[model samples]
Target: MQDLLDKIVAEANVTPEQAAKTLDVIKEYIVEKFPMLGGAVENLLGGNN
Candidate 1:
């Protein structure tokens, strides 16, 4: 998770905190909209699914 966050921060030229918050919002949206695919997305995002 840290690795991906770092990559995003570098590539997007954003702060680490901003990257993290963006990821959190995206994760929440994905899990909410696609309830059935939540586990798969969570796994891909490095969550314990």
Candidate 2:
């Protein structure tokens, strides 16, 4: 997910830590909104690793 992190850092003009936190928030929101997709989301996003 380094690619995603790089894109977010460049496009959003945010630090790496901020970008990571943003991703975490988004992942949580998606899982919360669609509980059934939690596994899929974790797989896709790599689960904050």
Candidate 3:
């Protein structure tokens, strides 16, 4: 994820926190639409399923 943050910072000209938040929102959107992926997302987040 550090690589992604670096890319976002360089290409999008955004802070690490902003990039992380954007990624989180996008991931949550996908999870909400495709609940089956909730498991994978939860695993990736290392949080509750």
Candidate 4:
């Protein structure tokens, strides 16, 4: 998770908080669109499954 956040921060020129929020939005979108993959995504992305 930290690795991804660091990449996003560096590539997007965004702050840590912004990168985190972007990840949250992406997580929510994925879970909403593909409910069955929610657990997998959470596990991979460091969230409560």
Q: Top model by lDDT, which number?
A: 2
By TM-score, how accurate is candidate 2?
Answer: 0.91
Per TM-score, the best of the predicted structures is 4
- What's the lDDT for all of these models? 0.84, 0.92, 0.76, 0.91
Model 2 regions more than 4 Å off: none
Give a tens-digit lDDT track for model 4, residues 1-49: 8999999999999999999999999999999999999999989997832
Candidate 3: residue 24 Cα off by (Å): 0.9
- Looking at model 2, the pairs that clash are none
Model 1 misplaced stretches (Cα beyond 4 Å): 47-49
List the candidate numbers ranked by lDDT, top first: 2, 4, 1, 3
Task: Identify the runs in model 3 with alpha carbons over 4 angstroms from their true place.
Answer: 42-49
lDDT of 2 at 30: 94
Candidate 3, 1-49: lDDT as tens digits = 5676689888998888888787788778978899999888776653421
Cα RMSD to the true fold for all candidates: 2.6, 0.9, 3.1, 2.0
TM-score of 4: 0.92
Which should have the higher TM-score, number 2 or number 4? 4
Off by over 4 Å in 4: none
Candidate 3 backbone overlaps, count: 0
